[model samples]
Target: MAFSELNLSTELVNAIPNSFASETQIQSLAIPAIVTQRDVLALAQTGSGKTLAYGLGIIERVHATGLQQALVLVPTRELAKQVVDALQPIAAELGHSITVICGGEDVEQQVQRLGDCPEIIVATPGRLLDMIRKQLIDTKRIDMLVLDEVDRLLDMGFWPDVQCIINDLVNRQQTLMFSATLPETLQAKVTKFLNNPLKVTANKINSVVEHIEEKLYLVNKGSKTNVLIKQISEQKWPQVLVFIGARDNADALCKKLNKAGIECEALHGNKDQAQREQVLLAFKQGKVKVLIATDVLARGIHVDALPVVINYELPSDPSVYVHRVGRTARAGKAGLALSLVCHGETAHLEAIRQLTKRALELNQLQEFPVTDKPSTGENKRPKRDKQANRRTNQKTRASQFKGKK
Candidate 1:
């Protein structure tokens, strides 16, 4: 359906770009209720137009010159910036200022920005909570609150801070919780914050879109880098996002790729906000061909026409598989999600398979095929071969006839 058909204000509808002729499923389901001040619980996969779904609602309810503000709590700094980027232009049109608050930046600078009294605040929960404690920002004026990426909020260790912020924002009239999958832990606790929310399930919680082509490759743990290098070289994909398990690995993989003659960059929590923003900008502008990032940084990133997402290391949670792959195949574009599964990592892949019904079966790379004891990360000789080699060594030593005890 068209944006104009969502029962939004005519002024708001006219502000949207005309190129957006029809709404995504999430937008179609969410915009109407959000505009009418209904608490919405949206369960949709990544890249399902969720940012705009709540953003438009935030815009529709917010008066540019009014004291009523909106607060959006997200799990990562990348997502907070993504939300602001998506809404800032349109908000500027209506004189609604969208402010972003996250760690790794100058607290004084953020304080100055907050002093401008932005009508909308998109922020990571931790930073937002810190500001709340310090009294640098006022949450009491917030009338609408959005909890994005609810499942991972607890994983991020922001549960208490989120709860505290939610309580401090005592004046919230509408609440929206959006996630690809909402775990039971969050479901029960979040109920108290919502007032009879309108639950909307756009898709099965863990299901992936039909457009993403999922591929799994089984390889020895040590051979993952070599195999990834070979794939990138052979395929020559325009852009690739590799999800590594840890910050150190993300850096090591990026270095390995660059040493192999492919331009790459690494992003993780250790990087300050300026550095994170720079790396993300370079990758988005095609200045960097390969971006190796940890789960938190890659989550909720907005990349257009991204053709591939490689799981260098599977995330700990099975549900995260959907978020990682969802980075590709966005906006109905055909994309590929290649998962590099090493021995002992099949359990993670198994969980992903169970979570989603996508046709994913493990295949071995020709050179990096499954080897004996690979699960232990060592290739050991067979027992018979060792015995034969020991006998040959004994014979050779006796022929030498020189023994030193």
Candidate 2:
């Protein structure tokens, strides 16, 4: 369905493109209620246009009042950037205004931006609270509050900040919370902060995309990297996103992939705002074909024809695996998730399998060795030095001996 059919204010739709289609179920059901001033608890997986769904409503509501009336709280800086980027056009369409405040940016500049009296404030919970404490931003004028990625906010230990923000605006604003899962803690927060919220869930809990083709490659630990290179070469996918588990891993993978002739960049928490913004813009503009990222950078990234997602290393948590693969198969677009499984990671893979409740299809790669040995020419030094290993072994043996004794 089109944005025009939603009965939104013409100015708001004009500010943003009406070409916007209902890409996800939550957007379809919740946008209408939200535009009509209903409190909402929407559950849509990451990368499902949840940002735009709530953004359009917030823009329309604030435009109606001719005052700043909305505050959107996100869990991370990356998400904060994505949310602001999505809403800015809509706000422009309505001749509305917005300001994004997050950590790792200049506080004075944000304070100055607030002086413009923006209609919407998109922020990370802590930064928002900090601004409020400094009396630089007013919650009193906010008429609608949105908690995007509600589950993640709780994960990041933002509950106290969320509560403080909510309490500050309790008198007059409507509250909306969105998450992929609604655990008991989130449920309690919703009850405490939202009054008569309209609940909506699109994908079933702990479920993978029904149409997404999932492939698991069982390769030897040493040969996995070679297998990844081979797959990338063979497919030559238009756009590919790879998920790694740590900042260091993301950097290392990107460097190796780039060295192997793939144009790639890494995104993670360690990047400065400018660097992160540049990398995302580069990826979106197609200057970069592959992006290696930690799951923290996974939630808010939007790309077109991103046909492939490679789990270069399996995620420790299942929810992360869901979010990683979710970068694709968005907007009804068919996509593929290929996980490269190595020997020691089987337990992690098993945990993920149990979490998703689906046995992933395992495939063996041709010409890729599945044995545990490293290639003959490769360095054989232990990841730790001999002395370090000796100390570790001594500790282990001492612990084992003590247990027996």
Candidate 3:
């Protein structure tokens, strides 16, 4: 079905950007349910056009009337800004406007923008909760609550704030949830917040799109940078997004990549919102060839036709691996996810394989051989420090007990 057949307003349909094709799987299935004012829980991949699934619904129910009718809760400041940027143009065509509320920006400025009474408010939980405490926004006027990337919100430990916001919105009438991958444990908990929501899974949950090619390389921990630089130079990829494990690592790796003649920038929590936006714009616009980012960018930032995502360091939770590599192979385009695994890193690689449910092929770059042997999992006894050895054994046993639940 086309956008016109989704039952959206003719004006709204006509206003959709020419760049956006008529329909994506998520939009086709979730838009109709939302337009009818029914609560919906939608599951779709990161690059599968999930935003428009609920964006159109919010646009249909609101106009330039100026009372905030839709409230969208997201996981990060980047995502909050991204949601507004995606919907504002289409919304304005129908006489409605959208504003973003997030931390790392001037709260007074945000309050001033809210005074305009946009039809939709896109916000992160912490800042939104702060606004409520100051009585900046009238929750009574919001009727639709959208938990965008709901699973990531839970991953980031926002359930308490989310619940508080829901309770504060005494008059909220409908709820819409959308996520790429949700844990079964969390699914049961979040469902109670909705009213018999129509659950729509547009794609396999916790899985990558079919077109993505997964590659694994086992290397010495100290040789990862050499291998990464070699691969990028060999492939001549126009752009690549690299996920690291920490904010400091992102900055450090970015500097080294630039030193090696690759135009690179880092995105992480340490950067203010303005800086993050500038870095993302550069990466998307082709000004930056490689972007070193932390997991914060895994969920909601969209880069059109990006062809590669590299895991310089795998995430702590295997499920997050889904969102990290999702940066590429978006919008039906073929992409690549290259992972560099060192000796001790095999545990993380194994976790990713388990979550993806694929026997991902492991490779050795004949050029950069891995000389470090993989861990044997055996605890070697220190003959000189008998007491210390006993202490280590006790700690290991306790850890094993904890792992057994």
lDDT of 3 by residue, 1-405 (tens): 789998877888899999887789999999888878889999988889898888988887774223358999999988888888899989887778788898998999999988888889999999999899889988898988999999888878898999999999998888999999987898998999999899999988888888889898888889999888888988999999999999998999988888899888999989887898899999989999999999989987889889999999878788888888888998889999999888787787788778778888779889898799878998777457888677667785555545434
Give per-residue CA lDDT, model 2, range 80-115, as digits (tens).
Answer: 887887778777766777889999889999999988
Greater-lDDT candidate between 1 and 3: 3
Better of 1 and 2 by TM-score: 1
Q: Which is the leading candidate under TM-score?
A: 3
Pick the winner on TM-score between candidates 2 and 3: 3
Question: How many angstroms is residue 118 displaced in model 1 relative to the true structure, after the best TM-score fit?
Answer: 1.3
For model 2, name the residue pairs that clash.
15-93
Off by over 4 Å in 1: 64-67, 374-405
Clash tally, candidates in order: 0, 1, 0
lDDT for 83 in candidate 3 is 86
TM-score of 2: 0.86
Regions of candidate 3 where Cα sits further than 4 Å from its true position: 63-68, 380-405
Model 1, 11-130: lDDT tens digits are 888777765667899999998898878899998988888888888888888852243888898998888888998889888888789889998778899999989989889888878888
Model 3 CA lDDT for position 284 = 87
